[model samples]
Structure formats: C-alpha cells, structure tokens
Target: MTTTPPHTDPVMHAIGLAVTEARGGDPAAARRALLDLWERTGVTGDPLHRCALAHHLADLHEDPAEALVWDVRALDAADALTGARVREHHAALSIAGFYPSLHLNLADGHRRLGSFAAAARHIDAARAHSPALARDPYGDLVRGAVEEVADAIARRDRAPRAPAPGPAS
Candidate 1:
C-alpha cells in the first residue's frame, strides 16, 4: 500500500490553495481565503506569503505601486529561501514576476493614473528580467524599447541639479 505524505500547516496550505484559486479567476474567494489563512496562521511576517498575497491583490485592484512593493518582498523571500523547491520557485518567479504581460498591465495602469515614472520603472524592470529576449523576435523589440525608456530615466535621474545660492551677502 502506498503511503501519503502528512499534511503541512493548514493555514499555509490554505494560502497556497487560495493563490491557485485566485490565479484561476476566483478573485473574491481567493481574497477571503487568503485573509482567513493569514489570520489563522499568524503569518503576517512571512515575506513569501506577504509578497504573493500583495501581488495577487494588486492584480485584482490594478495597483502597480502595491505590486511593486510585493515584488520587492518576493525578492527578499527568494533570497532567504533555502529549500530545493525554493530555488525552483525563485527561478520561476525571477522570470515570471516581471513578465511583460503583468508589467504592461502595470504600465497601463500607472499611465492612466498619471504616474509616468512608475510606468517607466515597470517597463525597465520587465526588460531587466527578460535578458533572453533575443530568442523571441517580437519580445526583442519590446525589450529594446524598454531599455531605451530605462536609459532615459537614468539620464534624467543623473542630470545635475543647480546648487543652492549663498544664504546672505
């Protein structure tokens, strides 16, 4: 007879399950389930879950600033993960987290909200994550544009600010 593995933390399991559901288009249930799972697990400080929940919530709300926060959290979690599966998860997230699809959505949202800088940042992040764009003809063009935008942002950020004048004569 085959033996089944023991179940892990119920709340963590529920959060994972909730994320799956959210990805499948059940936003309401996913949100409720994630909140319940977090409450039950007392997992507010878990960077991974925090990031995952934040990203999914941002997606549901079309909020790039929120999503950006989550993305940073996710990167922190990735750095701390020590398991084999964690490595795999990190690899996947590193590639998928800044995918053009989501980045484009964020850019559009930011643009509509009059956040040109945020929109540009997302495009830059998306391109940075897509280093292998040469393999995809269409993606290469999009990546090229993203690089240009990033360059422009960098130039603007680097431009020298005028020095303050002396206080008194």
Candidate 2:
C-alpha cells in the first residue's frame, strides 16, 4: 500500500523552507523568511505555528540571550497548544513531547549564559518531562541532549556547544 504524506499548513511549509534555507547556507535569507512569517503568525496566532517558528528561529541565533528569548517564546507557545490542535498537523504529536526539547534548549542557553541555577532547573524539568516521549529516534535524541546539557550545567561550562545551530539543529 502506498501511504500518503500528512497534510500540512502553509505556515509549516514556509517554516520548513526557511529552515532549509538556513541549512543550505543562507542564514540571512532564512532569518528574513522566518521573521516575516513571525509577523504573519502574530503574537496570538496558531500556537503550533508559533511554537515551531520560534523554536527554529532560536536555532539560528548563536547569542545565548537572543536564543533564550526565542526559546522562551517556543515554550510559551507550547503551553498554549493542545493535543487536538497538534493532531491537525501530525496524529502522533503531543504537546507533552514538546517540553523535553524546549526545556533542553532553554537549559543549554542558560548554561551558555552563565545562568547555571536556571539551567539546572530547566534540565531537571526536561528530564521530568521526558517520559512523555515515545521510544523512537526523536525521543532518544532529546534524551541524549538532556544528558549533554545536564553535563554542561554540572561543569558550569559557559561555552557554546560545538555544532551550535543551523538547519540541522
């Protein structure tokens, strides 16, 4: 049987394109595209779109402070999302699944910014929320990241992790 691709919203398509641009070595274009989409998404637009766009936008920033702002936006948007709403994009998605990665990013950013206490809090939160993940590659990936960031916090490492962020991030 031939399985069909899941239907996606235009905003998601645009977000994907912008991410692709960043991965394809045109971060300036990617930033512009995502920023324009952010304006379209507005402050109270679709929670899923806002969460996704903000998350990816954070990946594009090397500055911990700027990235922290976007990561916080992603986390906030995730809180506003619902399973029913996310199911519109992917039947397998859960808002609970979003927290591990969101908190991981925040933890990493805080660690980089010398906010070890906050980083520890977020890393612990990421671990606490990790059981919501499926035993798939995505789950494993986030779990690995949790460990990595936790170690960074423990060492009080205030440097950016190698392979910092981009399309692949």
Q: What is the TM-score of each candidate against the true structure?
A: 0.48, 0.92
Which residue pairs show collisions in model 2? none
When summed lDDT is taken over every stretch of 10 residues in candidate 1, the lowest stretch is 160-169
TM-score winner: 2
* Tens digit of per-residue lDDT, candidate 1, span 1-169: 2322213434345666776676676868877776665455343465445544544554444344554554444444434444443333443233343355345445444544556788687766676567644455556655654555455454544222221122110
Which parts of model 1 have CA positions greater than 4 angstroms off?
Answer: 1-12, 23-25, 40-44, 62-85, 88-109, 132-169
Badly placed stretches (over 4 Å) of model 2 are 1-7, 163-169
Relative to the true structure, how large is the alpha-carbon lDDT of every model? 0.49, 0.88
Candidate 2 per-residue lDDT, tens place, 1-169, comes to: 2322333478888888888888888988998899999999998999988999999999889889999999999999999998888777777677899999999999999999999999999999999999999998778888988999899899988989764343342
**How many steric overlaps are in each model, in order?**
0, 0
Root-mean-square deviation of every model:
13.8, 3.1
For model 2, give the 10-residue run with minimal summed lDDT. Answer: 1-10
Prediction 2 TM-score vs. true: 0.92
